[model samples]
Target: MKLLKQIILLFSVGIFIWACGSSPINNKNIEKEEPVVIANDSLEYEITIIDIGFNLFLNTIAQPEGYYSQEYLETRNRIFVTNWNIRARNPSQFNDNIYENVIDYQPNIDYGYDVNYKLFNYFMFAQRKYKMTLGAGYSRRIR
Candidate 1:
């Protein structure tokens, strides 16, 4: 009985060590590719951009309207800056080329005032910082 317990203990330890020794598999040879835009009209392009931007904002910010204080917003903005820095510095860490896609295919359309404020601001920041041409002349007046 003692021998069986000892054997089980050793097997458990060996399994644990083997698991710890394994590393995540990364396929370095697989090249990252940009999404192909097939929209025929500027409206379709604009809508796609808005959709992507809004989704990104929802995933990263995730704050409800009027729920956060000014200080919290500032802190969150700082966190965004940090995350952007990491992405800019380490492109390999990301699998998608959404950044480049946004720069290349962002539409020039006049959006409604309340349609996509958060995404607009995000793209505006990207335009200013990264010199991306994100429909600068095409956006409607923000009321």
Candidate 2:
């Protein structure tokens, strides 16, 4: 009986050790994209986007910096921001996870070409990732 008890205890200990051991995660499949920081010291503005795959999208998918005029970017941004804010307000109606925060974008304040460009690209990236449309009149193949 004593021998049986010792064997059972040894088995339990081994099981515990195996259960507590950490399994190695496959890191190769994961692409750790860094946060995109859009800042303009002159305007005293900064926006850090930490969404995964955004950096990759901006680098590979988004158009070049000078592709879109500043006015065009601002126009699109206004429409996108308005829709985004509405969705954020009504979480029950929209996906709360996707529309997490309401963007405080002022139409009067000129956030510069850089800020507008980045923000517009972010909106584009979010639309593609979440499979949602902010506003109409934009083609699916916009890059």
Candidate 3:
């Protein structure tokens, strides 16, 4: 019994020592590769006026200048909000003057993804409130 206990104790100590002495798990073997950023090549804008429910009378407008800048974007957002309120109050009048009052207005600059997304959301709001069917059947392709 004495010999058996000594052997068990020795085995347990060996296991403990082995466990403690082992190398820690690490990701050193992983190769550190730099991320690749692909620049947009095409001049085509991803967000079309149609996507934002403005295809009725408005032509496809290019991204506004300084659209990437937060201040400029916020200013444009204010304009959109004001227009939205005006349109909401008088849907028929807004629709009639959309071509002359809204469509002709263009931002003289290019914008990136962020501005495009904001415009998209704003148009979506217009569609919902006005009960207009803009960009109908285009949802399936996006998915």
TM-score of each model, paired residue for residue: 0.30, 0.75, 0.26
Identify the runs in model 3 with alpha carbons over 4 angstroms from their true place.
1-61, 64-67, 96-117, 120-143
lDDT of 1 by residue, 29-104 (tens): 2222222222434344332343233344444554455554544444434444444445555567643453434222
Please identify which of the two predictions, 1 or 3, would achieve the higher TM-score against the true structure: 1
Write down the worst ten-residue block by lDDT for model 3: 29-38
Residue-wise lDDT of candidate 3 within 6-122, one digit each (tens)? 999999999999988835443332232222221223634333232222332122342343435655454555466455555555766667433223322235435444544456444
- 76-100: candidate 2 lDDT, tens digit per residue: 9999999999999999999998888
The alpha-carbon lDDT assigned to residue 134 of candidate 1 equals 31
- Regions of model 1 farther than 4 Å from truth: 17-42, 46-57, 64-108, 112-118, 121-143
Could you tell me the lDDT of residue 63 within candidate 3?
38
Ten contiguous residues minimizing lDDT sum, candidate 2: 23-32
Best by lDDT: 2
- Of the pair 1 and 3, which is ahead by lDDT? 3
TM-score rank order: 2, 1, 3
